[model samples]
Target chain A: TQLLEQSPQFLSIQEGENLTVYCNSSSVFSSLQWYRQEPGEGPVLLVTVVTGGEVKKLKRLTFQFGDARKDSSLHITAAQPGDTGLYLCAGAANTNAGKSTFGDGTTLTVKP
Target chain B: EPEVTQTPSHQVTQMGQEVILRCVPISNHLYFYWYRQILGQKVEFLVSFYNNEISEKSEIFDDQFSVERPDGSNFTLKIRSTKLEDSAMYFCASSDRDSPPEAFFGQGTRLTVV
Candidate 1:
């Protein structure tokens, strides 16, 4: 079973549209990270949020962690084709070896 | 910027054959990791190594799987017998700290078992 669940497994939108993707889990995590991956390449780290109820923004992309630390969301405003890629969320639990648990990922496609 | 480097961008091996994937993590990093991703699927964590020992492993990592840091800079993963299900892109990663720190990844080695 997947440790983390991501919503909207796939997304397709036009330029200038706004969209939000979600990651949820029943287990609380000490930290959560988001990454973006293009074709034929490894995932690139985007941001890491450690505190619950925390919100961070990278230009047009906004990330928020749930108050309970069991969920997170990524929101993009005025999306462009450059934003098209697979978005992944991974979490590290408070227990164990600090290895990450990853969600399936959300594939986004923005048509220009 | 420092980067993780993996060898053999792609490999084609027969089932029941042994294959070793090698990685050179960023210098001065304290932790090393191996992750895999099947086509059209999420990245799965396989194992994490620290202080010359395996600190964590996933259920997917079976007896046939083994990891080693033979030298100061190289981390290697060995599959004693490859299975059809083992076909995937294997990524090597490293981090400077153990506390969910920023992990840098290699381009990944695509393994094809037939």
Candidate 2:
């Protein structure tokens, strides 16, 4: 069984602070994705990084895939109250894998 | 830019009752999936459907659960019998062959078993 573990289950910070959430695993994956979910909403795809050592940015958020494809990270620069939400990472074994196992997620709270 | 859509933002049912959660995946997507998130818990994969058949399902997807495409656009998940433990938010997702790993999810339906 593959397991994706996310760090800092909960984080509270003031506005303008920078933070990073991590997702680590013992197994390699062919692809990984990051999602942000607000209350009462589904997981919204933030980005998908397929190559090891690859990085993608979406405005204030930066996602990096591990060099070994066994881990990933999300970095938020100058996080504002609007950046607050549950961040999740999911990994797939290969292109054909029907299901992607998800991490427990990190709940981030940014206060102004 | 299309999105997956799920019906009945919330559902309430009694123990031993049957409930069917419905979803309409993106018209052009190929892979469809069902996942559940218990209150304060992580989202877990229940099953995956493709090509008019079930491609994969997690251990949590037992005999009590069933999934069907039913039509060209609708995918549904049926719970044969409800239990308190089944109370959670169910989300439907779809991805296309162009980018098989980028999945779009529905807002989800919150199922409460009384």
Best by DockQ: 1
Please report the interface RMSD of model 1 to 1 decimal.
1.2
lDDT of each: 0.93, 0.92
Listed models, DockQ each: 0.71, 0.64
Colliding pairs, model 2: none
Task: Please write out the lDDT profile of model 1 over residues A1-112, one tens digit for every residue.
Answer: 3399999999999999999999999999899999998887888989999999999999999999999999999999999999999999999976647589889999999999
lDDT of 1: 0.93
lDDT, candidate 2, at B10 = 99
**Model 2 chain A lowest lDDT segment of ten:** A92-101
Question: In order, what is each prediction's RMSD in angstroms?
Answer: 1.2, 1.4
Chain B, candidate 2: TM-score:
0.95
Docking class of 1: medium
> lDDT value for candidate 2?
0.92
